[model samples]
Target: MNNEQRLLLLEKAKQFFRDEIVESHITRACAKAGKLSNYNVNPFLFKYLANFLKGNDDPRSIAEALVLPRVLGSSINTSFGMRIQKLISELFEGFGSTTPGIDIEFIDAIDGSKKYCQLKSGPNTINHDDVETIFGHFQGTINLGRTNNLNIGINDMIVGVIYGEEIELSSHYKRINERYPVIIGKSFWHRLTGKDDFYFELIDAVGDVALEVDGTKVLEETIDALSIEIEAKFS
Candidate 1:
């Protein structure tokens, strides 16, 4: 990519952080607090006493456990995971595949060869089932390529992780890594755009955009509102 494409990609990442991460999380949190945060305290204490008795649990923690865990987890695992793929596609002028097992389809930055990548947000993102699923998907991609005479190699099918060291990979990912090339963190970002510092730059972009969107203020307000709601309803 040239200078223009690089700038555009940077802007897009910042936009995603502001709109998707900050704004969307705030909206969802407020909505959830409004809906289910009014549970009766008597029944809640009667029913949830066991959960909070031996642990240092309060209404805030209890609420987080009940509502915020799934909400935040889905935002990171599904939403951010998806946007990262889209940004990588934008960087390479390619697209993520709808084809099973191939989350990313692009030409390598340094080598300029087509790559089929199974993308993950973290080293430990997959389970045993995901390992097997990726293996099957890679095999399918290879077979499809061969049928079309595209000369796709096993090495062309890789697993790309957004943030982690190779040694930090979980057993499931390690198993997949044994069968296919696994690229992580700085190396993975470098593959998308032939720049070693791009990973740190991307992190900086997110952090900068977060502040620009008043992420701190909104998040604190959301937490305070949630804590108060939970205390009123369940304390």
Candidate 2:
């Protein structure tokens, strides 16, 4: 990528982190968390587990249980994943896709070929049903392309995982890769921007944005809310 394009991409990346990560961090992090009513607590299990505790007492363990997993769960992942699909579409100047399995159709920046990509946030994001859905959509697209006299081929189809290496991918992704090309991490970014260094550059931009944006207020509020629930139950 040229200097101008690099600058624009960096600006977009910063804005995305602000909106998706910083702005949504509050609600997204505590979506199913904070309030006791929001989660189903297994006091029996906690009691059993906390029985084995020495310095770590029951109340503290319960409090941690009430907050940690709920905050760390897939709420943020799902929202950020959806936003990533939109951002990637924009970055590639992609067209809105009519194909069911495809997110967007765009000219490959590096090779100048038409690419139909099914975008995922990470390697292990998909499951068995998703596997069926992707295959069904891909096959349907192929049949339609043939009928329409299009030049679409298996090589034109791509499964794009925004992060992770092939060896570390889950079974679902490995299965998908068996049928179609899987581009991920640096390779995925390189294909889009035609720069070997674009991946590292984007990572640097993400790090800079993280350093600039503050989410302490949201985090504090979430902790306060969770603490209230903990006190009510433990007191």
Best by lDDT: 2
Q: For model 2, how does the per-residue alpha-carbon lDDT over 1-235 read when each residue is reduced to its tens digit? A: 7999888987888787877776676665664466667766676675554445433545555655556555556666776787877777556564668787788777777788988888888888889889878888888888889999997999788888888777778888888889988888888888887888888888888889778856566555665677677677767
Query: Model 1 segments beyond 4 Å from truth?
Result: 33-78, 90-92, 215-235
Clashing pairs for predicted structure model 2, backbone only: none
- Leading candidate by TM-score: 2
Q: How many residue pairs clash in each candidate?
A: 0, 0
- Write one digit per residue (lDDT tens) for candidate 1, span 1-92: 56776677788888767776666666864455434534343555533653654364675555555445445565556667666676666555
> In terms of TM-score, how similar is model 2 to the real structure?
0.87
| lDDT comparing candidate 2 with the true structure | 0.75
Q: In model 2, which regions exceed 4 Å deviation?
A: 47-54, 58-61
**TM-score (C-alpha, index-matched) for candidate 1:** 0.77
lDDT (CA) per prediction? 0.72, 0.75
